[model samples]
Target: MEESKPVSYYIPNPDDDPTNERITRITNKIKIEDLIERSKRIKGCKVFQLEGRFVNLFNEAYQAYILGMDYTTVSLCALASERLCYDLIESSKITFDGRIISNIEKESFYRIPFSELVFFSKSIGLLPDKVAGKMMKLNNMRNVYIHPSFKRDRSDPEKLQIKPESDSVTALNNLIDIISGFGK
Candidate 1:
C-alpha cells in the first residue's frame, strides 16, 4: 500500500495541515528577519516629500537593492525619480509680475514625458542640478537595461549592455543622492 502524503504536497492547507503550518511559520519568521535587515540597509532613506506613492516606490526600490534584484532596483529607482519630478512640477509655479506661469493641469499631467519632467524641474529650480543630471543618467541606464539594441549591433553580440550589479549600485546611489537632496 502506498503511504498517504500530506495534503500540502498537492494543495497547501496551512490552516489545517501541520506541515503547511510549519512552513507558513518558518516563511513568516524568515520574512520578519529579512524585513529587519532590509530596513537597516535602508535606514538612511526617507519618504520623498511625504507622498505616499513616492514613499512606496522608494522603499520598494531599496528593498530590491537589498534583495540583490539589481535590475529591478534600477528600474524602480528610475520610476521613483520620475514620480518625484512630476510631484515637484505639479506643486511648483513660476510667477512673473503677478501672472501665474507654468500652469500644469492635473488631467494633462501624464502627457508630459519623463525627460521633459526632469528638465522642467531643473529649469524652474524645483529640482537640484545634480539630482536632475543623475536622474537623467539613471533614466538612460534604465532604458538601456530595458532595450539592449547595442548588443544586437555588436560584432560578437555576446556582451551585455550594462554591468548589472555595478550599474545597479550606481543607479541606487544616484537615486539616493537625489532623494537626500529633495526628500523630506
Candidate 2:
C-alpha cells in the first residue's frame, strides 16, 4: 500500500492562519530596514541625486515615526512625495502647449495646486491611477494636519485629537514607493 500523505501538508486557509500577524509584522520590519538602507545609499548615487530630497524627507519621516511623531512624519512625507512627483513630471521631456518643458514652464507647473498637479500627471500617463489616487489621499491627510479648520469636525471640544499610528507608517511607505520610482 502507498504511504498516506501527512495531514500537515495541507495549506491552511488564509483567514484562519494564526501566524499571519507575526509574518506580517516581520515583513514590515524588513521593509522598513530596507527603506532605511536605501535612503542612505540614495544620498551617494548619481541616479538618485536629483531626487535626494525626497529620500531625505522619507528618512526624516522614518525617524519621526520611530520617535512616535507619526502625524508629523506622515504630513512631511506627503509633501515630499508631491514635490518628487512634480519634479519627475517636469523633467520627463513631456511637451506642453506644443513646446518642450522649459525652466519657466516647469516653474509654472509647480505653481499649480497639488490636486491639479495630480490630475495633470494622471492625464499625461506620468502617474498611474493608483499612485495618483494615493497621492491625493496623502494630500488630503496633509491638508487635514496643516489646516486648522479641518479639526473642527471633532464631536468633543476638550479631547486631544490623535490619528492612528499605523496610518502614518502606511502613508509614508506608500509615498516612499511612489518617490522611489521617479528616478527610473
Candidate 3:
C-alpha cells in the first residue's frame, strides 16, 4: 500500500506559527541535556546504561519532528517508548519482585504490541494515571502509521498535513518526565 505523504515536505506552512520551531529547538536541547546529566548520576542503572540506545531513538524522533516528518516522528516516538517500557518492566521486576524477568519473557512481551505495553504499564502503576492515558493516546496516534487498518482518510493527499511541531516537543517532554528521575 502506498503511504500517505504529508502535504508539504520540509516546507513551512504559512498558516502555522514559525516561532514554535525556535522555542522547540531551545527547549529540546535543554531537556536532552537535563536528561543526559540526570542519567549520568545513575551509572549502574539499566535505564542509564542503556540510555545510548533508546535515548538516541528518542532524540532521532525529536529530530524528525523538527524536520516536519510527522509520521516518521510518531513512529520513532512509539519505538522509543516501547524500548523504555521493556527496560522499566525488567528493572522493576528485578528491583521490586526480587527476580530477573527472563529474556524469553521480555521478548514475548515486546512482541505483544504497543497498546498492551501502555495497559501493562498502567496496571502496574509504572506511570501515573494521566501520563498513562497520554501514553495510550500516543500509542493510538502511532498505530495510524504502523497498522494499515487504523489509517483512515488517506485519500486526501493534500489534507495529509504534518502534525504541528509542538506536538513532538510536548511528547518528548513527557517522555523525559517519565524516565528522567529513574534510580534517582
Candidate 4:
C-alpha cells in the first residue's frame, strides 16, 4: 500500500463545529428515519393545484422546511404569494389590482408593494378576505426576519419568538391553506 498524506484535503479548524460539516458523515444531524417520517407529512397532505412557477416555489418551500432551512422556507412562501399577485396583474386588465392599467407611466403600475398586493387582491374578487389576511401575516413574518428593524430597542415582539422553525412551518401551512381554499 502506498502512503498518502492528502495535504490538500480540508483540515478542520479548532474553532469550527464539526457537526456543521461532514457531508460524507451524515450522522449526528437529522436522522434518516426521522427525516423520512417528516417528509411523509408532506406526501400525505392534500395536493393543491398551482401554476408552473408556483409549483417550483411550493416544492422548494417544502424541501427547505424539511431540511430545517426555516428562513428560506418562509421567504419562498412570501415569494409565491407575491408571484400570485403579479400574475393577476399580468392577466387582468386592472392595475394594482384596482387602478386602470395604461401603456404610459409604466413605473407606477410596476411598483406595487406586497401589502398592497395582499390587500387589493382581497379588495377585488381575486382572493378571499381570510386568504388575503393570511398572506399579509405571512409577509409580515418574512419581513421580520428578511428585513430586521434597527430601532436599537427591545419593543419588537417578534424578536422574542425563538427559532425560525415555527414561523417557517406556519408560513408553509398558511400558504397551502390559501391555495386549497381558492376554489371554495
Q: What TM-score do all the candidates reach, one by one?
A: 0.66, 0.62, 0.54, 0.69
18-114, model 1: which lDDT tens digit per residue? 6666667655644556556554544365543465377788778887877767889889999988887766656666565787555554435568788
| Better structure of 1 and 2 per TM-score | 1
lDDT of each: 0.71, 0.68, 0.61, 0.70
Q: Which scores higher on lDDT, 2 or 4?
A: 4
- lDDT by residue (1-184, candidate 3, tens digit) is 4544676325556776767775556446555555554344322313445633677887787666655555676777767777777766655653236777665666666677667777877787776666566566567667765675664466775454335354455555555555554433
Give, for candidate 3, the lowest lDDT window spanning 10 residues: 38-47
Cα-based lDDT at residue 166, candidate 4? 71
Which candidate, 1 or 2, would have the higher lDDT against the true structure?
1
Q: Candidate 2 lDDT, tens digit per residue, 70-163?
A: 7787788787778777667756887867888776767878788889988998898898787787788788777766776655347864544436
Write model 4 residue lDDT over 113-170, tens digit each, in one string: 8797677667777788877887887787777666556222357544454347677778
Ranking of all candidate structures by their lDDT, best first = 1, 4, 2, 3
Error of 1 at 106 (Å): 4.4
Clashing pairs in 3: none
- What ranges in model 2 sit over 4 Å off? 1-52, 151-164, 177-184
Q: Which pairs of residues collide in candidate 2?
A: none
TM-score of 2: 0.62
